[model samples]
Target: MTNILFVCTGNTCRSPMAQAIMQHRSEWNVQSAGIFAGEGADASQGTKEVLHAKGIPFLHQSQPVTDSLLEWADLVLTMTQNHRDLLKQQYQAATNKIYALKEYIDPDYEQAWTELKEAYAQLEDQKLVGKEMQADVIRKINKLEKKVQNVDISDPFGGNIMTYQKTYEELDNYLAQLVKKMENENR
Candidate 1:
């Protein structure tokens, strides 16, 4: 069984919701934690409500991301590119297995994402030399931005139930794609 770990800024919202959704849909071992979570905090009410509406039961206690948890997961899927980068920086050994959830499931986004990163780095380097960003670089960045627009899942931490529901729907859709990809790989 593949062990998947979902991560976000706080365990109260996105990560736990993803854990619930994935667990309900697959037999794979699933768990979640946050990069800056306070231990034992309950999942947010909006998260709880949305999961209940979707008929996916979940109980969660917030916990900080730990090395042991990272070690346990076969895949470490973060809710945002920033979250994925943070883990990669701090836990270099796990970098190979870490990915932002959308980027992991959607291979079409991968090339654009790599090129975007390179473009951004080039832009930064030009700035260091006190040169203005070239028009071509700017255009490439803008195009890549559109292609990777959905790379990060929306954070619904303080939103109302409707906002939470929207986030849930977004996560559910990507997760369905994730399941299909994994199943096909196994086959």
Candidate 2:
């Protein structure tokens, strides 16, 4: 199973919502963390209310992101680009598998995947390609990657209950879509 790690600032808000949503929804193994060390983090009342409204079970434990979690994750999905940047800079070795959660939910996934496959094949071609051609191909693939990237999900950390509920809805929706994609890929 693919192991997914969702991250946010405090773990009380965004990351917990994502963790709960993805854990129950996706076929993949899902976990969550906060950039800051949350020693006594419990789910906020707003968070709890929203989850209870949706009938999502709550398991409370607040842990800061650790090297072990980074190493264990197959993919790390941050709530925002800033969070991704922070994680990448701190854990450069794991940058290869990190992304923003909404970043992968693009409408042009098929086209983007096709281009990525072609780029990988070019890199592996038995016949040697000239250095310039290889560089050009690499640049093109990177551009395509940006085009298909998911937009960073917003943080509703200090917002009211309505805001938390809205955020929960968005998280749940995207996670359900992710689960569907995983199922199709496995089939």
Candidate 3:
């Protein structure tokens, strides 16, 4: 079975919600953690209410990302590009299996995303040598940015029930896509 680890900032909102959604839809071993979560905290109330309304059962305790958890996950999907990048930087060995959720599922954005990563790396390298921003690279980044939709799953930590529901719907849609992709790969 595939082992998927969903990640976000605090673990009380997005990641747990993702874990519940995926668990409800598939038999895969699924879990979630946060980069900076405190241990043993309950999921946010809005998260609980939304999941309950959808009839998706969830039991979660916030935990910070750890080496053991990283090792357990066959695939680590993050809520945002920043979360993905942070995990990649911290665990270079596991970089191959880590991706932002949208980036992993959206083939249309793949080329644009790759070029943007390369362009950002080049820009950083130039900065280290005190060079001015290259016009071509700047142009490339701007163009690619327009092509790539925001890959972040919306955070609903302090939002009302409606807000949390919207976020849940967004996640549910992408996760449905994820299920199809996984099934296709296994075929």
lDDT of each: 0.93, 0.82, 0.93
Instruction: Give the TM-score (vs. native) of candidate 2.
Output: 0.75
- Local distance difference test, candidate 1: 0.93
Q: RMSD in Å for candidate 3, one decimal? A: 4.7
Pairs in clash, predicted candidate 1: none
- Model 2, C-alpha of 170: deviation from truth (Å): 1.2
Q: Give the residue spans of candidate 3 off by over 4 A.
A: 114-141
Q: Each candidate's TM vs. the true structure?
A: 0.87, 0.75, 0.85
Better of 1 and 2 by TM-score: 1
Cα-based lDDT at residue 35, candidate 2:
94
Over 4 Å off, model 1: 114-138
Query: Which stretches of model 2 miss by more than 4 angstroms?
Result: 107-150
Number of the predicted model whose TM-score against the real structure is largest: 1
